[model samples]
Target: MFEQALGIFLMLAILSVLIVVHECGHFLVARLFGFQTPVFGVGLPFGPYISLGRKWNTEFRIYAFLLGGFVAIPELGDETNASNSSEAFGVELNPFKKFPIWQRALVAVAGVTFNAIFAYFLMVVMFFSVGRQVEQTYVSALDPSNPIAKQAGVLAGDDIVALDKHPVTSTHEVIAYLGNRKSTPVTLSLIRDGKPLDLVMTTSPKGKVGMVLGQKPAQYIKIDAGPVETLGLAGSELVDRTRLMVVGLAEMVQALTPDFGPAQPGAPPKPGFKNLHGVLAVVKIGAGMVQIDWRSMFMFTIMISMDLAIINLLPWPALDGGHLAFMLVEAIRGKPIEERAHGEMVKWGFLSLIALMVLVMVNDVSALMNGELDIKPEMKEKLKGR
Candidate 1:
């Protein structure tokens, strides 16, 4: 229990710190470009900041909300005048009253780049400092009670070395391989008590393996590499993870439409704000990481970080992506749009965000009540079979 609590604390601390850094990237870039920044905060205007600072003598000041931070740049509500500049009323940076379109776009993109760097560094530390867990290729428990195990001649303690000619490294891979019930007669390669063996297993109707396996202690393996190789690996992983998240979100959105299959068959028909997950999910995942081993925990953290970075890149109001979209249009048209038009767009975006939040909260509550969202008792039992 103490271990779990400590793990939760660490996870939360890491998440909070990373988010603050991400926001800081934007704040710093905006400040460098001479934008007027005011208040910067995190955690929905309610949470307290861990650190706060400001430029005392200068025209602009900085504050760290600890929970999160943002630069109150000069571009709010059509006002683009630099804070220190004494320009005409309602006018921005000299000609257009705001920084160049490219400058604004760079400010928006900076946060995302920072997040990717943060994730990469975190992964490097997780891999080298903590070490990676070795692949577990054994079936720790066959549970004689499980019919599928019996049918496949796989007894408890049997070491499953491979699946359909593919090497098995972890219990996760074991389930993923055997869980293919949709494919008839799954193949398996086993090594029982030093004797090599081959076998085939069948899946249940729901594409389940119908059996559970356990894991042994994690083995610490060393990675030998120069700084260049280490940096390359980290960068590659971050890029891949980011790409996966962006593609996954696009697929999810596509799935929500009527042209696709039924809309999750459980919630509302359209994709709205309610689908948005907030701090609750963050807290839960952080808590779960401590309970599990470090490798799983850190891997999950990487996934979540990738998700956060990608989600913020979406083109919607009040988001970096939205700001980016406007900048792009300005770049193409050779001028910024009217202030009134931009304000209306922001207003609609705010309303949409609020509506979506309500839906997500409802969905979270519903999932809690239905016992579908949280890990089920049976699933836990299945995981612990080893």
Candidate 2:
């Protein structure tokens, strides 16, 4: 029970920090543009609010429910509105609406931008401290019953150089390359005993080419990287991680279709509703990582930061991306959208967001009841060996 509580605490702490940083981006940028952002808060508004003092005319707040946060910038317009009048927060240099469209757009984008920047910084620190571990693209194991591997004539110890002409330096690269190609024949370039060979194999319906790549070393030899080198490496890693996440999301969407099939024997499970995790799962995973190592926990935090950035940038209503979309329309049309229309759209967007949260939570509970949260047998064995 204590372990569970610790995990929940850690998750909330990490999430609160991320939310605060995101809100701070909006608060600072809004203040810079002379817009009145009266409230900068951590946690959702549904919780009990505690004032955390004030700075720069902004009321900082901490809420009881520590899931997410917001920066409340009153609607920018003429001073006639009660909220904009002297009775409320004092009138600022300019109303939020009076600001140039470009400035407004920047304020909307600031939160996502800050999240991405934070993730990048975390990546740099991770690389510097733990050093990067580049896994070799060598076939380590193959299930004899895997028809695809047997037909492809792949052998243990064969070094995979490329897939369909795309150079692959690691097992993850190979998986990402093949995972996107369902029912497509792929050319695998391999080197075995100093002999180069080409083999062809079609992926299963589940998009898996039944084989496991060699595990990375238990201990990596850290290389000291200069500032320039570290930046380059971090940037490249960020791009790769972003690409993988996009692909994973796409796969999840595909899984929602009725035709989603089962995984092949000994193959990793296919993406499906079962893969949709919620806050509970996140807390559990975060706590588990904390117990394992600080490095792992830091890496998880970085991944969550990037995920937050991407999710906010998605062009959905009530999201930062949705606000940016409106700004884009306003820019092209040379006028702002009607206030009523904007408000209605945002209301629907909020409803949609809430619905999604409920759905994910339901899925999380179902998974827990079904005992599906445990690691797979194969993965468990691998972890034990490590």
Q: Judge candidate 1 against the unseen true structure and give its global Cα lDDT, from 0 to 1.
A: 0.63
Provide the lDDT at 195 for model 1: 96
Please give, for residues 223-248, the per-residue lDDT of candidate 1 as tens digits.
57776787676666566556555655
lDDT tens digits, residue span 127-216, model 2: 887765444478888866566976679888888888988767656678877877989999999988999899999998766777878743
Task: Name the runs in model 1 displaced over 4 angstroms.
Answer: 1-11, 46-53, 56-68, 76-97, 133-220, 260-277, 369-386
Index of the highest-TM-score prediction: 2
Candidate 2 residue-pair clash tally: 2
lDDT of 2 at 202: 96
My TM-score estimates for the predictions, one after another, are 0.65, 0.80
Per-prediction RMSD in angstroms?
6.9, 4.9
